[model samples]
Target: MTTHPAPTVHDVRHEETGEGQPTTGLDAFAVCALSGAYSAVAEARRFTAAILEGWGVCAPVVSDAVLVVSELTGNALRHAAPRGPDAAESRPDLVCAAWLALAHQEAGVLCAVSDSSRAVPALAAPDLMAEEGRGLWIIDRLSESWGWTRPDHTGKTVWAQLPVPRPTR
Candidate 1:
């Protein structure tokens, strides 16, 4: 199996205060690099939960968020490995690298997992006893809204937005 490096995450935000200076806001964002390994799914799940908790997202939503992250990240790793087209120049000869981002929106939390493929995900009718092919189904049912987008940079991103309980970090 080939391994790729995880990218460093960065955040840039603009905020304001009473005197238009700076004040804390409810919005939050976090990102992490993911390798196309099976274990990255678990890491995605844990990362989602941690970010939600840190942002004071309620417990029930946090659980759902974890599941969403796991499913999307798993699917990306499964399908987008051994990078083909739209490979970044800086990271050429890539076996496959991915990224996961979580943003705390005013109405809900948005979780996105992006990989090096433009293929869209569809709901698969897996056998009742089957262990695989249920990721998209779970994401559809749990999230308030979900969709996939092909970014200008490279590959596609599968995203799920979950409505979180109002609270503070």
Candidate 2:
């Protein structure tokens, strides 16, 4: 999977507050571009863990964020198409790409996955013994809140926020 370097994290003052405090939530974020391969799911999890840890996110929140990222990335890879006129065309030589973004909030971390499909993710009522169709349910149970957005017609992004305890610093 091809990945992009995260933007440097630095103290970002809130313009309205006029205080030199650090930026949180969407203002300070990290993103990874995932290739079409299934391995992208694992890569997204690893990326999430590293970024959250580096940002001093607590262990439990980091764990939840990683799982959420994995499920979202996996769903996108399995069900969504790349944005383009040729999106439906199968090209063995070319791999589709998805994007994963993680932002550190004051009390939680926000995770989002963007894919080229306009289809919204829905919860499926699978049988109790079914191995599939449980991603969204798991996300709902683990996240404080989760939802999706369509930024234009070319794609959709599913996002989740995982609560974290404030640090003692």
Candidate 3:
């Protein structure tokens, strides 16, 4: 068996400010295999939770935010596999990457997932009979608003905004 190089974090950017102030943001990125690995998902969730917590997010909202990351990561893993096993082994440089951005906007936290896949995500039709195909739909219902941005033909970033909880007097 061959060994795969561990993923590395790159291009991390962050910003923060007081509540009722201008938008602040935090972003983390990693490059890893498209295989269905628990470690990859766990790391992504942990990183996301950390960023949200650092930005003074509540526990419940942070949990939900992590779920969004999981969904997006799962989608990337399912769709963005390398050409073949040998191709992956011979050239690890083509590995798929996951980019998570948590931005504090006037309305809420904008969570964005960027991947090295060209395919765009869509909400599947409601199907009580089906067991799968509802990730985007669930994201839409949970988030205030969501969309995708394709800066180039090679990749796209899907983002969703979760409203901040109103403070109690």
lDDT of each: 0.77, 0.76, 0.64
lDDT of 3 by residue, 1-169 (tens): 1111212223333344566554334343323233335466677778778877887778888888888777776666566544444746744655445556667655677677666667777676668778767777777777777777743544667777787797789
RMSD of each: 7.9, 7.6, 9.3
Tell me the deviation in Å of residue 1 in model 2: 32
* Rank order (by lDDT, best first): 1, 2, 3
lDDT of 1 at 43: 85
- Native-to-model Cα distance after best TM-score fit, residue 43 in candidate 1, in Å: 1.3
TM-score of 2: 0.76
The residue-by-residue lDDT of candidate 2 on 1-169, one tens digit each, is 1112222223234444357654333546898889877889999999999999998888888888888898899899888845446755744333457889988877688898887776777776656798778888888889888887744455677888788886668
TM-score of each: 0.74, 0.76, 0.68
Q: Runs in model 1 with CA error above 4 Å?
A: 1-26, 83-96, 151-153, 167-169
Clashes of 2: 1
Ranking by TM-score: 2, 1, 3
- Candidate 1, residues 86-157, lDDT tens digits: the string is 535656855447899999888898888888776777776767798688888888889988887743357777
lDDT of 1 at 119: 79
Our model 3 lands, by Cα RMSD against the true structure, at 9.3
Q: With candidate 3 superimposed using the best TM-score fit, by how many Å does residue 102's alpha carbon deviate from the native?
A: 1.9
